[model samples]
Target: MYEGLMQKVMSDSKSKAGQYFTPRALIDSIIRLIQPQPGEIVQDPAAGTAGFLIAADRYIKDATDDLFTLSEDQGNFQRRQAFRGTNGCPTPTAFA
Candidate 1:
């Protein structure tokens, strides 16, 4: 849901939002370079809408082949605890 919304917003405002948003491919490439481990925390201090953090989450899930296995506590931890993004802007809905 959120990914679709973000994609739409990004497409609509590409000229303006390009600096604020990171492309999924680039984010994935960065995550692969960093190689976030299980249980490691990933953070983006200048996160616009947590594109990096979301990409890291996807990387971990894809690594484990458990993106849909939320019934497991490990999966829950990966989804909820593994990554965080803090924007300088006041409480963006993405962080909420």
Candidate 2:
């Protein structure tokens, strides 16, 4: 719902939203298809807002019962190591 609203705002704006942002629905669909697993590294080299990485993390956590199925070490790895994105933003930060 929030992404939908963000999409609307981006589309309605005259800024470079189209260039910087992708529709969340598409991101969710791609993440669903990719089905990133634990231990597998997922990266977005040109990440704008890190949407793809965020969606992939959510998808994996949902599939893995919030990583309860993983060992503590594996879960830590998933939270910190599995998703990586490179961006030019001066204040890059994880969404979670």
Candidate 3:
């Protein structure tokens, strides 16, 4: 996904090349500061291949292994009751 974005950004002559990518070190630092949690929502207006979102997802999963251990039925019920009234959590399509 990031490779595709990078290719597009690099190919675009009108876009500011400097803004096309976020340094990995900086991304790691930001993830540490935000400390994402399970069942929490996160968004980035300028996601740029969703580095922040991905980092946050990994951080949350790593940080709260216990919290994420919901039984299958409990997890399904929680997902159905929350958000858009879906029957399942759908395995979290995005990082947040």
Candidate 4:
């Protein structure tokens, strides 16, 4: 859904929307270079559509299988500690 929406937006705006959406592969490469640790907070303060946060969350889960075995408290802490994104534009239509 977002892909189609992004395509339409980009086409309509003649590439102006490209600035707002980072390519997922580039996002993944940056996350790999940073190598976020388990307890460390990964935050994207100027997160547009939270692409970084989503990729980081996936990377962490793929790296750590302990998420399934952790106690409820530990799980809660991990969930809270990992991947925070702020200031995402609330409405997609607003971009248009």
The segments of candidate 4 whose C-alpha lies over 4 angstroms from its true place after superposition are 1-4, 10-19, 69-72, 88-96
Q: Give the TM-score of candidate 3.
A: 0.56
Q: What is the lDDT of residue 62 in candidate 4?
A: 77
Q: Can you write out model 1's per-residue Cα lDDT over 1-96, one digit (the tens) per residue? A: 565576575665645534355667788899899998677888888777677887787777787875564447776777778777876654334764
**Candidate 1 runs further than 4 Å off:** 1-19, 67-73, 91-93
What lDDT tens digits, residue by residue, belong to model 4 across residues 1-96? 564576566665635534456677898899999887666788887675677877787777777785765667766777986666666444353222
RMSD score of candidate 2 (Å): 3.9
Question: Which of the two candidates, 1 or 2, achieves a greater lDDT against the reference?
Answer: 2
* Residue ranges of candidate 3 with Cα displaced over 4 Å: 1-18, 66-96
Rate residue 44 of model 4 by lDDT. 85
TM-score of 4: 0.70
Using Cα atoms with residue i matched to residue i, what is each candidate's TM-score against the true structure? 0.64, 0.72, 0.56, 0.70
| Model 2 poorest 10 in a row by lDDT | 87-96
- Backbone clashes per model, in order? 0, 0, 0, 0
Candidate of highest TM-score: 2
Q: Put down candidate 3 lDDT per residue, 1-96, tens digits, no spaces.
A: 653555565665414434445666798899898776556666666555566766776676566563368666544543443222111222212222
Instruction: Flag the better candidate by lDDT, 2 or 3.
Output: 2
Of candidates 4 and 1, the better by lDDT: 1
**lDDT on C-alpha atoms for all candidate structures:** 0.70, 0.75, 0.54, 0.67
Candidate closest to the true structure, highest lDDT: 2
Q: Report RMSD for candidate 4.
A: 3.6
The residue pairs that clash in candidate 1, if any, are none
